[model samples]
Target: MQQVRAVVAKAKNAPVSIETINVPDPGPGEAVVKVQACGVCHTDLHYREGGINDEFPFLLGHEAAGVVESVGEGVDTVAPGDFVILNWRAVCGRCRACERGESWYCFDTHNAARKMTLEDGTELTPALGIGAFAEKTLVHAGQCTKVDPQASPAAAGLLGCGVMAGIGAAINTGAVGRGKSVAVIGCGGVGNAAIAGSALAGASRVIAVDLDDRKLRLAEKMGATHTVNSRETDPVEEIRRLTGGFGADVVIDAVGRPETYQQAFYARDLAGTVVLVGVPTPDMKLPDIPLIDVFGRGGALKSSWYGDCLPSRDFPMLIDLYRQGRLDLDAFVSERIGLDDIEAAFDRMREGDVLRSVVVL
Candidate 1:
């Protein structure tokens, strides 16, 4: 085992600390990664607030890019020198979903069998099975997907989570197509990504809805054709007006709340798609909308889990796209910081100003 400096959340609502943690050598089907950079995700904050579970002493980084330092016996998908983007969904091929060829929905996934621990021998629950805010971390071999080493780690690491979810919400789940009209609510990192994805998919009109003007401006940089400040005006009305009095062909609710959900539902054209990529709290409930409206909409209402991503398939392709200048991933990296700055990053995130603060290890 090796002791490395890692960010550890010791208790709910307590400040995180940089502590020495014991990282084990790779065992069977496992690998050790030297983390180059990791993006701060809201999920990490959820874990800190005890929203994910009561698991304390949580290791809190998941969106990361790194180089494999070592691999266990019988591992051949990647080697020691491979550059990779770490993913939470490490598909287990024997699962029923995989048997049906839908590996993205694989009920069973793999994580390192061994656990990392505090200096005192207390076990740590790695966030999303991928605690990467450290010098090095251990994970299943399948969690490491090789990507172009030429890409920036700060940009590439984001594909490990939120950015991928937004892009996939538009391109995959929403099926955004050429000449289609699209509207995305909540222009955060994920919402802006949906706007980018919709534009990449050749959407005729891409409307971005947000309460913040700063984010709406950023959304424009991400390929929004029109911007609506929801606080200033009614989003549903503005969306309908933008799409020629018909709602957009695809409306994505990137902010997962009852009000935003209802706005997304009513803001889509009949037979249009509504993709909910935003995560909702457990206490939050879907507000009462007419059951008849649900049946009469004649469109798909879907929830996106990790953008329904197949990391192995999507990671390399997106990295290549970024390299080719087809995708502007660099826009997502608001600032790069040292690992010690994570607590400050959390404050920026809570204030809703920073798109992403990357911990550059």
Candidate 2:
């Protein structure tokens, strides 16, 4: 067993507590990672608010990059000293999706079986099976994807989740390509990522829509050709105006609310695709659009799960791009903090003050 400092959310709507916990040796098919950095994500806040589950004493943090410290018996995919990005979905080869050659849709993803415990022997429920806000974390061997060691931990860790989701939303789900016109609604981290993805895919025109001017400015730096303040103007109208009155070839709703989704639905050209990458709450409802509108739209309405990314394939490639200076992953890192600052980070996130606050261990 290894004793390590970790952040724990003891109850719903409560601040996270830093405590020393006992991390067990990896079990079969597992590996222990010495976390270098982890990003504070909205999902971690959701887990603390009981939005995800009633599991208390939850260990938070998932978007992480680390070095492999040790491996359990029968593990060989990675070994100690390898720099890796941790992924939530550890694809199970036996799953139906994997059997059919769609490993990205693997339904039976695995995690570490051995539980990390509090000093008093209470077991901790790990967020997204990662719990990376600690000095070290145990996960399934498949969860570790090797990436370039030259990249900063703070920047590389973001690729494990939100960054990947945004890039994948445009490139994978939306199928953005060269000369395409793409409009992304809600210019936060995810939306900006879609813009960058679209630009990387050689999109001719990229329109960004957001309520915040600050985020919109960042979107331009990330490769948006046009910016629309949705709070001041009708985003659908602005997108249409920017795309030669025909609307964009692809529209992505990164906000996930009914209004934003509806805006994305109406802000695309005839036969254009719509991608939903934002997360919606249970209380949210779909817009009251006519069924004929859906059929007449003449294109696909798709949802991206973690950008439909295969971590092993995407992480390394993205890191290579980052190293090549084509992808600005570092711009996403607004601040860096220690494990004790996560609760404060959550407050900043709620206030929309930072794109991402990384926990550098």
Could you give candidate 1's per-residue lDDT for residues 1-361 as a string of tens digits?
Answer: 8999999999999999999999999999999999999999999999998999998999989999999999998799999999999999999999999999999888999999999999999999999999999999999999999999999999999999999999999998999999999999999889988999999999999999999999999999999999999999999999999998989999999999999999999999999999999999999999789999999988999988888889999999999999999999999999999989999999999888788999998
For candidate 2, write residues 242-342 as lDDT tens digits: 98899999999999999999999999999999999999999999998899999988988898999999898899999999999999999999999999899
Runs in model 1 lying further than 4 Å from the true structure: none
Error of 2 at 265 (Å): 0.5
What residue pairs are clashing in model 1?
none
| Best-fitting candidate, scored by lDDT | 1
Model 2: weakest 10-residue lDDT segment is 186-195
Q: Candidate 2 has which clashing residue pairs, if any? A: none
The C-alpha stretches of model 2 lying farther than 4 A from their native spots are none
Write down the lDDT of every candidate, Cα atoms only: 0.95, 0.93
Q: Give the distance in Å from residue 20's predicted Cα in candidate 1 to where it truly belongs.
A: 0.4
